[model samples]
Target chain A: MCELLAMSANVPTDIVFSFTGLAERGGVTGPHVDGWGISFYEGKGNRTFKDACPSSESHIAELIKSYPIKSEIVISHIRQANRGCVSLVNTHPFSRELWGRYWTYAHNGQLTGYLDKFKVSRFQPVGYTDSELAFCWILESVVKQFGEQEPDDLNAVFDYIAGLADEIRQLGVFNMLLSNGVDLMAYCTNNLCHITRRAPFGKATLIDTDVVIDFSKETTPNDVVTVIATRPLTNNENWVVLNPGEWKLFRKGELIRS
Target chain B: MCELLAMSANVPTDIVFSFTGLAERGGVTGPHVDGWGISFYEGKGNRTFKDACPSSESHIAELIKSYPIKSEIVISHIRQANRGCVSLVNTHPFSRELWGRYWTYAHNGQLTGYLDKFKVSRFQPVGYTDSELAFCWILESVVKQFGEQEPDDLNAVFDYIAGLADEIRQLGVFNMLLSNGVDLMAYCTNNLCHITRRAPFGKATLIDTDVVIDFSKETTPNDVVTVIATRPLTNNENWVVLNPGEWKLFRKGELIRS
Candidate 1:
């Protein structure tokens, strides 16, 4: 019912080009027109911009498009309002601090009876969205299972997340993007695709807008940048769709295989 | 040292004019130019804008100045880095969620050996800053003393905060502005001032800038807006200075008393 977009890069990079394509679908090209939000991680902290307005026409979104705030990890969402009211509090890409790291999350699908099924602790959802409630439950479970310290074995953590995603998928579609400024995670049940661009990156044209960008001119030969979205933003790029119940993790734009 | 600014209003009011004056102090008029940040509460969730660059020269600050984002509670800070490095993570107006409500804080002074003295649990600081450490301690203490739920007696909570402020002030100057979207608290150890403007408002001129705003034209008769800053922002208005170790709680622009 919503759109999700995220970026992971070897170096600090801006998502202006990719975000532009997604912003168009928020209102002009597609039907998701409720609200939108984006988070850019800078080390342990993150800067977030959220607006309860159509991203295609929002002034904040316009600023984000024009100004280039480079970051190593980024997550963005455009909402269509499936479970919560259209307001600033119910905006997507919710964040909470855990393990001395800021964790940001965005969801693209709806869940049923999530409040009754999920168990929450330390982290609480301030908003009334099922997406936020699910995020809180995930974080609380992580803290409870792993104690206060950051988990040592990332593979085990990813496997745990995959199991949680499977359970959440039972209620309904569970597609999500989560990051802790270091590792970017993507879980897919219904719709999620990703593309990684590296040295041989050439021109890529947006599917929604009449815009073309030559990544070779903008990026260094060594730069590795990966973008994940609910649907492909560029028609020319080969985006790999994730199988249902599959979860993947990326660090420095490279997928970490178990 | 840093410059702190906050506002509490009976209705959702824009603090653009006041923020403009503070923005001038960030680099144009004053030396506190390491970074700046602001938190605007829109119900339980708050929207934050932070920049490592000086506010006077930041594009984000320009957007904040031009756009009118109305809020009932706001907390802002302009840092002259002393205790922490000049980066986005070290920026002031640090925020965390507790008791299902977002708590935001900004400090105007530095503490010595804060990490050694402050006791922290449950809540942790993502960034390395003496101010943020103190905030974590306060929130942790509140949770440890109180329970999971929001305290029933707000006055008791304020008193508890005042006691914690006193303890933190013993280390060094500890002027701070804290809020939970519903209540705004000001703690003073050295420099802090406040002015409440209601009906029968008059013209006010900024001390840091040449801009002048007529409050009577912009405000309604029923509007009550109270602004707290490290120093009086306006040159013509009378600002009540707080005594050392004094803490004041405000709700809906009115000072709360025992």
Candidate 2:
């Protein structure tokens, strides 16, 4: 399995600091160094950087550390390559267009027999990877449900997604992160974790490597943030662990369930 | 609108490097400097750090640069006050639990007149942000569709989510990102961008800040990675731009649409 990370904040914040720590694992700390990618959301568009090398040794990863790209919502991944060939088109954090907005997605687990059930129209896989095929399958489902026109009911759309996830989970592990330009949704069939930060800041130390940061000094009395990941990155903070076959929704650093 | 940053790699990677340039915008490079947060995925959980202050001036942000935490996936956010006050409850990247797994979500656009229609039973908002309310509303819809039992079909799930998104978009901008532990789903009603990386490498540069990195030096001959963002992060790369009303699904760094 691979790992996942995400953040939701109230202000334009830089992720370079946190990214610096993760880069070490690309080739030094952990074994996820098959490939790496990052995406940053600007006003209406997004900025994305990716590499097929270990983030720890990748020059692109190093540059990302010094770049300081800010965003309100973000998603990232590191690959271990279980299903597809190690190619650029098979990297995590894939993108597509729907309903006049950009949709980004990434996965951390493998699914069996998915190809047997997955199908798409004119959309073809740029690379021969099960992950990309799954993404296209999802898009095809959306088009089938709403046709060319977009749906007008948010609830209906979510219900449809949940249904799709449930079906895929049956095939195998199906942990995932998904987003449009507006909101974020998460599902876990195997492993996942998350945490929310609000006022009364505290200190945190990384678990995978030696690193610590005091958030109290960097934050005001009023600020809220929420993060999601496949594993716990910090050693000090109490990360919330997710059970198999679970899912949640988040926005603006808070949890909202309808 | 707000901004989002994400990183994924085969090995553990840190976000600090890219965040440095982004921090400048919190109050310097851009206007999103209301608050910030970051999350890194480790083994089965996440390590997160957040602050309400502008990252440009925050000591915590600096400390992150020096830290060496590593993970496969990382998500970071910088806020721009839109709905809700600048308080802890009103940050981005909200998180929640359902069916045992942890879920993470975030939003970039506003949802006008959403408060009146969105409603939830077992789940309620801890904050007063429209984004949170939307999240809850989506969850509620899922529960209503599938009840407590998991759906039997994956395509059905995607159809439901896409339908819900279409419905919500009618209310206003509905771009968003969501994930569980298996896959990532992205929806675009307005703007979004994404890029993928694999074996053959290339060079790229940051658009918002002055920075450049080469992938050829860091990556192996076999590697694949993808990234999604609100806007293109690099000035030299040809990032795939999302059209209005488009959505895509990703699994294991590959695209899959039914």
Candidate 3:
């Protein structure tokens, strides 16, 4: 098993504080030390930084923690190497383009014998990781049903993805976070939690590291930022834990569906 | 116009020395200062770092210069935007997945009305740059000729890509560098140069910066390394300039086809 983190914001926001807490777990505070990756959606495209090294000791992760890259949507993961060997190709937060839109995905749990179940199609996995294979299958299924372009009914698309998520969950734990620079979807099989910070933002203390941040000072009243992680990063703020086999869709920091 | 840089080597090599010269051209020593990006292939998958700021001043570029992420294949670009706005989405080098392998591309020239000429198909451009549009068209054509799997006859694939490069060059100047991790292809319309360093390695000096490196201390006699750029990066070394409408394919630092 690994760890997952994601963010959806109404405005461009930095994940420095939240990511700092998660980074600690990548080798410092927790056992997830295989590798780590993060993707930040700027517009139609997103930039990703990945390292096969432990995030706590990675120079790239240090750069990420110090450099505040503001983005509306973000997805990140810290791996523990359950299924695949630790390598750059096996790093999480895998990305692919569909319907002219860049899609990013990160998974936290292992799915045993996934290759035998999933059928390969237009999209193929460059890496041997089960997470990447599952991601490729999901995109292949989407393209099969809706053709190359994104369907007119987004609810239908969400429903399709949720159904696929449940199917993937049958094999093993399948906590996942996926996005297309617009909608962020989190599906839980074992663990996932989310918290939305808005107008009356108060001080929050990190659970993993010795850090406290005043959200009110950093955010405007109009800003709505939702952060989702495999485990809650902050102790003071209440995080809504997702039940097993439950999935939620969020757009611009607001939960649109469950 | 932008600037392009690429490398192919038999052994895993760090491009810190060549990249330093190119980084200087991004703002300090030259005018191509809109944005910059680079892709380093580790295996079938590649990791890309991009910034919407000038490479000379970008924190990410600074990190790249300091941290030596060794790779066998590398593609990099610094932009002086003309067609698209200076933003992360429009930064080169653009990448997409094809045949389960990550394919990266960077271009140094423009096509005025690429949208009117090129037809969109399986692959589409996330960014509205002619370079990306041309890249999409090339991949679409490849998929049309060959299925999802890479063809066994690589020469046929290279010929197809060169044909597409010629077609895009008809619209405007189209100097490009493309790779699928294993093969590095450089297509020239106006400016492109390459230098291969091997056994008799000696001292080399950068043109844009006050830095010199002695290859004698860096490599074994068996190593073969090729560096491709929009212009000669080193002042002391003799670089081979590609002719207009010429394209070359390199694998493991050796020129396989032209």
| Candidate 3 Cα deviation (angstroms), residue B11 | 0.9
What does DockQ give for each predicted structure?
Answer: 0.76, 0.03, 0.79
Candidate 3: tens digits of C-alpha lDDT, residues A1-258: 899999999999999999999999999999889999999999786899999989999999999999999999999999999877899999989999888889999998888867778988688888888999999999999888888777789778878999999999999999999998889999999899999999988999999999999999999999999999999899888999999999999999999999
Q: Write down the lDDT that model 2 would get.
A: 0.68
* Cα deviation of B38, candidate 1, in Å: 0.6
True contacts kept of 3: 0.73
Give a tens-digit lDDT track for model 1, residues A1-258: 999999999999999999999999889998889999999998876999999989999999999999999999999999999898999999989998887788899998889977787767578888889899898888887777878777788677767877787888998988999998999999998899999999987999999999999999999999999999999999898999999988889999999852
CA-RMSD of model 1 = 1.1
lDDT of 3 by residue, B52-138 (tens): 999999999999999998899999999999988998999998888888789999998878766777787688888888888888989
- Model 3 residue A154 lDDT score: 79
TM-score of chain A of 1: 0.98
| TM-scores of chain B, in order | 0.98, 0.88, 0.98
Clashes in each model (backbone N, CA, C under 3 Å)?
Answer: 0, 219, 0
**Tens digits of per-residue lDDT for model 1, B1-258:** 889999999999999999999999899998989999999998776899999999999999999999999999999999999987999999989989887778999998878867777867577888889999899999888887887788789778879988999999999999989999899999999999999999899999999999899999999999999999999999999999999988888999999852
Best by DockQ: 3
Q: Give TM per candidate.
A: 0.98, 0.52, 0.99
